[model samples]
Target: MVQHVWSVNELGEWLAAVRIDPAIFDLRPDYCAGLMVVAGISSGPSDTDSDQWLQAADSCDIDLDDVHLEHWRDAYRSFGAKPNRTRPSADALSRRAEKNGLPRINKITDTYNAISVLQRIPIGVENLDAFVGPARLVRADGTEQFDTTNDGLGVAEHPEPGEPVWRDDTGVTCRRWNWRQTPRTAITDTTANALFIVDALGPDAHQRAAVAIDTLRTALATGTPSATRYIDTAD
Candidate 1:
């Protein structure tokens, strides 16, 4: 896999350093487990994998009213943002898959989505070829351009000031701490190099994020040569 420079910026450093709501361990710090891999996309999920996806969706039934999830949601709220407005992608996908069937995107995207639902962690994947790194996690200055779609028409927007986002030299790669990804780095069937970011909360974040990353890495390795690297401020 290709090696890309990744880092947390000054704001990210501050967020990682501060302690918030001592009663809630998830609010203590920001820890992310990131993996960069080079792989070919599969046409689609197999019948067996589709069945596993459904099983994973069923397993998350309890999350519909899970207090732990509420606490996790609250942790994000402490950052001065609304959870519903900036809900982690994993939380949204899990809820949607639990209600409707998971949308089949592609092998790489679907694989990470399945793992996200099963592990209950936010996983963000981006096409490395579309980026001009070094990749960084920082608070947005409200000037970074975000290319997205609205009502099937293309739209370009800017991130809110102080919003947590991942960016490259060009513009915002991901906004709202994984709520939305820009089209510039969206993974498609032709994407050959990609980056997977697993974000976790709570006291067991390190262990949980590690497991999620390893699971995805192992899954991808079965089809192609894959490599992984970890990023954790707590360490």
Candidate 2:
């Protein structure tokens, strides 16, 4: 079950030898092992806060089927999603992404809901200007186009008139996922900095998610500890 699909970029001389906040050089404390996830993926009007992510996915159990409930009802009929399912609680994904305008949570979305409540898997974080470049999570071929929190405008994630996506770019700053962005490309309250990404798939979660993203790119690649080149696409 080496379920494959891979991608990762940055480290362009360590993201141009930034300054700080690569989560303080990957916040290593033995470089984490399992679970510590926190994920918030509200769509316009906060995708009506799907019970604050279904009680953070039942405080950790992430059980959802029917092809992830048909990708949350096809992301609520392709951009207009609110009640983000797996629900009955987070106040039902936050009263359905707050009637379509739930922008307020920060820190790269609370550090991706604290790593999706600590690694239940299926992680997500967005907003590199809501994307158009640096986006290629790969897998989606139904004619991409999404983003129209009712005409505020933006669309594409399944518009296979040409086919191919799973995208999440930043090349030209945001393309479409409908509306899970727009704090001028999100991660606001002055997002000091971020780019922490992880997915860890197949073969025992791809050698422990490639040693947990090379122990977070070698404890943030500037102090010590080395060895990283992800994009292995675990087969």
Candidate 3:
């Protein structure tokens, strides 16, 4: 078993170090991020996990017009990105779940995706082993490196200036806030330590995010889960 070495203090310190640009809150005062850091995850996809994903997909009823989704669209527009051209992560997942159900990526990925669809929130998972440093949410300046894939080939890209992104010391890990994730820190079957981010908006964003995080913790209980701590940027 590949046990993670993140002690309680280290985990809390790492999550505590996650910074969000004050400008982001200025753009959308309702914006809130619910971050959960978990280690000691030791399970692969199973029949139960598949059932949970399927249930969430089957129950998904979100559309672009959803109030929560509209908040994300407005945030994207505030950052000079077209939401229709690049939908929010939750919007894309909801569409997929409605059309053909969500894809089974892996146990960890499936767990977070299920919660995202079921809760109508955007969730991102990161493989901590690939992490370069503490995560930070910032408005990009167009010079950071983002490792992604195009036409099945690995390539590098950069975020547009002033675009919202999640990054570390290396570069951008997720571009446009929650639109796309770089392959550099994407969760895989071998992932044991993971960071789960649940994004919400509107006046009740913090409450909604807390609910989503609770749901995530319950679902992850099927696996050998050990959560380090939970942080809500709204605090």
Candidate 4:
């Protein structure tokens, strides 16, 4: 399998160019368990690369006028978080967001939804397959296990401590489940499309996820100047 690392600049550039206008599409977010994966090309079935998706809100291109940065603040008001939980992990932060109805959004909005959230459902898409398979939600037991980080170039496997990971049946890896992707599986300049979803851990999740995915697909198809496909995670 080929390993790649997408540097912050590279990822940001992709987000900037992502088709958002002339389309009624919205970004969806959901996270569950300990997992995250990439959204595009894999050379083969055994090929799994460290996949990481950065929040579009963090990017300058995302519009925050209607929606503030903290969209999930109200979602967590009813649900209680750990008292001492300052700087909640991606898993914790996303779980709170899920309780609240995720709004229709742009690239940033759609990017992080595939993983994290209370339901723990990380969705992944490839250019071909409906949904990612041969996928496994496992974390590195210790620092000794790690995928490469995208420094804008390419990366190799290295030792990582306490770094949780989502790996495919193959050796490709990413870090912190849905939070960050290692360089190895990181999306790069070559990526044309992606398979994305958040890990889910709830009962009503499928229905909710389907609504968001379907809405996004319709919106995207209608809005984009070019044609593309969107698949529901539950499918």
Report the lDDT tens digits of candidate 2 across residue range 108-205.
Answer: 34333433333333333333333333334322344444432445655433332221123443221122122233233344443323344443333354
Model 3 TM-score relative to the real fold: 0.91
For all candidates, what are the clash counts?
0, 68, 0, 47
Q: Which ten residues in a row have the lowest lDDT in candidate 3?
A: 222-231
Query: What would you estimate as the lDDT of candidate 3?
Result: 0.80
Per-residue lDDT of model 4, residues 73-94, tens digit only = 2222213322134222333434
* Deviating ranges (above 4 Å) for candidate 2: 1-42, 47-49, 52-58, 61-115, 118-124, 130-196, 199-203, 207-230, 233-235
- The number of the candidate with the highest TM-score is 3
Instruction: Rank candidates by TM-score, best first.
Output: 3, 1, 4, 2
Candidate 3 local lDDT, 116-184, one digit each (tens) = 877779999888767887888888899999999999999999999999899999999999989999988
Evaluate model 1: give its lDDT: 0.66
Query: Cα lDDT of all candidates, in order?
Result: 0.66, 0.32, 0.80, 0.34
Compute the lDDT of residue 82 as modeled in candidate 4: 25
Clashes of 4: 47
How many angstroms is residue 126 displaced in model 2 relative to the true structure, after the best TM-score fit? 3.6
Q: TM-score of predicted model 2?
A: 0.24
Position 182, candidate 1: lDDT: 86
Measured against the true structure, the TM-scores of the candidates, in listed sequence, are: 0.77, 0.24, 0.91, 0.38
For residues 123-212, what per-residue lDDT tens digits would candidate 1 score against the true structure? 888886576745676767798888889998888899877667777778888887678898878887666656677767666777887888
Candidate 1 residue runs with Cα over 4 Å from true position: 1-30, 39-51, 58-60, 65-68, 222-225
Better of 2 and 4 by TM-score: 4
